[model samples]
Target: MQTQRSFAKQTTGTLYLVPTPIGNLDDMTFRSIKVLQQVDLIAAEDTRNTQRLLKHFQITTRQISFHEHNTQARLPQLIATLNAGQSLAQVSDAGMPSISDPGKELVIAAIKHGIPVVPLPGANAGLTALIASGLAPQPFYFYGFLPRKTQQQVAALAPLKNRTETLIFYEAPHRLLKTLASLSLAFGEDRQIVLARELTKKYESFLRGTLAEAKAWFDQHQPRGEFVLLIAGNPYPQTRADAYQHLNLHDYVAQLVTEGHPAKTAIKMVAKQRQVAKQEVYRAYHQF
Candidate 1:
C-alpha cells in the first residue's frame, strides 16, 4: 500500500480531480476555476461540454476528450504527461469527477505511476440530494447506477434490499419509471423513497413518498431531468421471523395470504422480504 501526501513536494506533476457544477453555475468553486486555469492540460469527459463551462468561467485551458470509449487510448498519453512534470486536471460534464463519472481509471493510473492525485472538493449530486432527502444521512450506501438489463438489475438490487443504510442511486429520466418498478419489486411498495429531480437547477424538485406513491406519480406526470433516488433502509429487524424460519416458500406465502393479503400480493411480498425474484415465489406458491 502506498501513502500519498497530496501537498508534498514531488518530482512528477500532480493529477487534480476537479469537480464541475452539477447544474448551477454558481456552485463552481473558486479553487476549481483556478485549477482549470493553472493546469497544463485538462482531461475532460466531453471536450464540447467542458468548453461551454470553460467559456463561462473564462478559463482558456486546452482540453482533450477522455471518456469511457477512449479511456484506454488516452491513459498512456495522460500518464506520460504527468510523468513529464506537466500538471493535469480531470473534470466530468457535471458534479465530481470519478463518482459515476469518467475519472476513476485515470486516478488509478496516476496512483500506480506514483503521480500525486489531488481532489478538489466541490458539488456532488448524491450527497447534495441526501442532505435534504429526509432519510437517514449517515451510514449511507451510494450505489450510483444499477445495471440496465432487467435480470442483471434485479440481481444487483436483491442484496441491497436488506441494507439498513439509506440507498442512493442515479437514474435518467427515461429509465426512471422502470427503475421505480424494479425498486418496488425488490424493496416492497411500502418502502420510503425520495426522488430528487434536476438538482441545483431552477426546476429542481423533490418527490418524497413510498415506492408505490412514486410509481403512481410518474405514471401520470412525465419524468423530467436527471434523478437522484434515495430509498429508506429496511425498518424491520434484519433477522428472519421465527415463524418464517420453519416455513417453506409455498407455505410462507400461504401464511401471509391467510393473514390478510391477496394471493398475488402475498407472493410479491414474500419475494421482496426473502430477496428472491417474484417469479420464483409465484412458482413456489403455485407448485409450478
Candidate 2:
C-alpha cells in the first residue's frame, strides 16, 4: 500500500517512465521531451536508437543501456543512482517502457527503495489500433507478443478464447502468418480481427476481417511491418457443461492434454468442471 505523489518533493530522486513515439516522430509529447532533457540520466533500451531520438529533439542528456539482456546487471547501478538523489528517466526503443520492453524491473527496484516512479503517458500502439479496430474498446486485454512456438502459442491462447473483452497482441511481420493461423485454430476462423501495420507511420494501414480472411489476405500480400492485432471477444461464451457435454470425463481430460495442458493438470481441470473428486477424475483418466 504505497502511494506516489509524483510531484512531491522528496530526498530521493524520482524515476520517470517516459514513453517515446511508436512510429511517427511527431507523436512524441512535449512533456516527454522536457523530461528527457531535464533528467540527470536516461536509461535506454537501445542507446543507439535513443540517440537518434535525442538528436531529433536536441536533447543532450547522457544515456546508459538498460535492455532485457542487461537488466539484471544494470538494476543495482540504476537503483544506486536513484538513491544518490540523481533523477533518472527510462525509455524503450519505442512506445511506453515495460509494456513489452525493458523498464519493469528498474521500476520495481525503485519502488522497493521508496523512489518515486512518475510515468508520462504518450503513444501506445495497442490503444491506437484498438480505437480504430471497430471493436468494443473499454474492455480490452493486451497480450503482447505470443509465444513463437506453435504448441506453446496455442496453449497460451486457449484460455483467452472465451474472453468477452477485446484482445490485443503485437507480432512481427515474419511470424504474422503463423500467428494468424494459430489465432484461427484457438478462437475460430470467423472471429473478427483487425491487423494494424506500421502504426502511426506513413505506411500505417488496417485490415479488418474475419481471422480466415486476414490470413488469406496476408498469404497474397507479404506482411510488411510490426503489427498490432485486435481480436473481437467471444460473442457466445460456452458454459462448462455446454463446452464438454459430448465427451466423457476421460475423453474431456484427454482433449485438454491435446491442447497442451499436462495430463495431471488436465485431470484436475476436468475434475473441477465435473464437480467431482480429483481422485475420481484421475482414476477414470488412467483406467482408459
Candidate 3:
C-alpha cells in the first residue's frame, strides 16, 4: 500500500528562487517580499547586502550567507534544513540568484533531494539591456562578466565575436574602457556595440555606434556605475563580389591556438573573430 502526495499535505519542502532589485528597491516585487517573509530561511550571496534589502521591506526572515566562496560547504547544511521539511528561499545581493552569481549548485542539490524549486520573478539587468538595446531578442548570449586582466578578457571575447546572436557582457565602470578596447581588437573597429551604464539609476546613459566611434565617446565622458555591453549579431555572409577585405583566417587561428585554445577550438574561435564560417577557418588550417 502506498500514499500519494497532495499539494497541501506533503511535507516535501520547496526552494524559492527570488529576484531582488538590481539597483532600485522600487523594482522589488510584492510577491518577492511575501515569499521572503514566509520562508523558513533565506540563503543570500551576501548577507550584509541582503540585510539592507530585508530591512527596507521589514522582512525578519533568518538569513544564511551562501555565496561562491562558501557555497560548496554550505550546500549540505542548507539541504539538511530542506530535508527537515522547511521551505527556503535563495537570493543574490541584486537581481536573480545564479544568473551570474550564486544559486546554481544549491538549486541542483535541492533537486537531487526531491525538494521543489520555484521562481519568484523580478528585475534582471541582463534582460533589461537586451530588451532596450533594440537588438535581436530571440537569440542572445549573456556573458556575465569578463576576466579582470585585459589580455585574458580579450581572449574571452574573441570566441564570441562570430556568434550570430546578440552578445551581452557585464562590466564595472573602472574596466569599461579597457573592455571596449579589447572588443574592438577582437570584433573590429566597425563592429556595432551598445553600452548601457548605470541602468535603473539616476545617471542612466546609452552610448551606441561602431567600436571606434564608441571609444571616442567614452574617452570624453568619465564612466561610473555598472554597465551592460551589448554587441550586435554578426553580419550575413558576404557575396563574392561584395566580399570585404579582412585578416586571413589561418594566420588568426594559428595565433590563438598558440594562445592556448586547441587547434579545433582555435579554428572556430578565429572564425568568430573574423566573422566567417568555420569551414573558412578549417580550410585555412588545413592549407598551412
Clash count, one per candidate:
0, 0, 0
Q: By TM-score, is 2 or 3 better?
A: 2
After superposition, candidate 2 runs with Cα above 4 Å error:
250-288
Rank candidates, TM-score, best first.
2, 1, 3
TM-score of 2: 0.90
- The prediction achieving the highest lDDT against the true structure is 2
Whose TM-score is higher: candidate 1's or candidate 3's?
A: 1
The CA-based lDDT of model 3 is what?
A: 0.84
Residue pairs that clash (backbone atoms under 3 angstroms), model 3? none
Q: Which candidate is the best by TM-score?
A: 2
TM-score of each: 0.83, 0.90, 0.81
lDDT of each: 0.92, 0.93, 0.84
Residues 1-288 of candidate 2 have per-residue lDDT tens digits of: 888888898999999999999989999999999999999999999999999999999999999999999889999999999999999999999999999999889988999999999999999999999999899997999999999999999989988988899999999999999999999999999999999999999999999999999989988999999999999999899875677779998889888887788999998888887899999998889993
Residue 178, candidate 1: C-alpha displacement in angstroms = 0.5
Steric clash pairs (candidate 1): none
Query: What range of 10 consecutive residues in model 3 has the weakest lDDT sum?
Result: 237-246
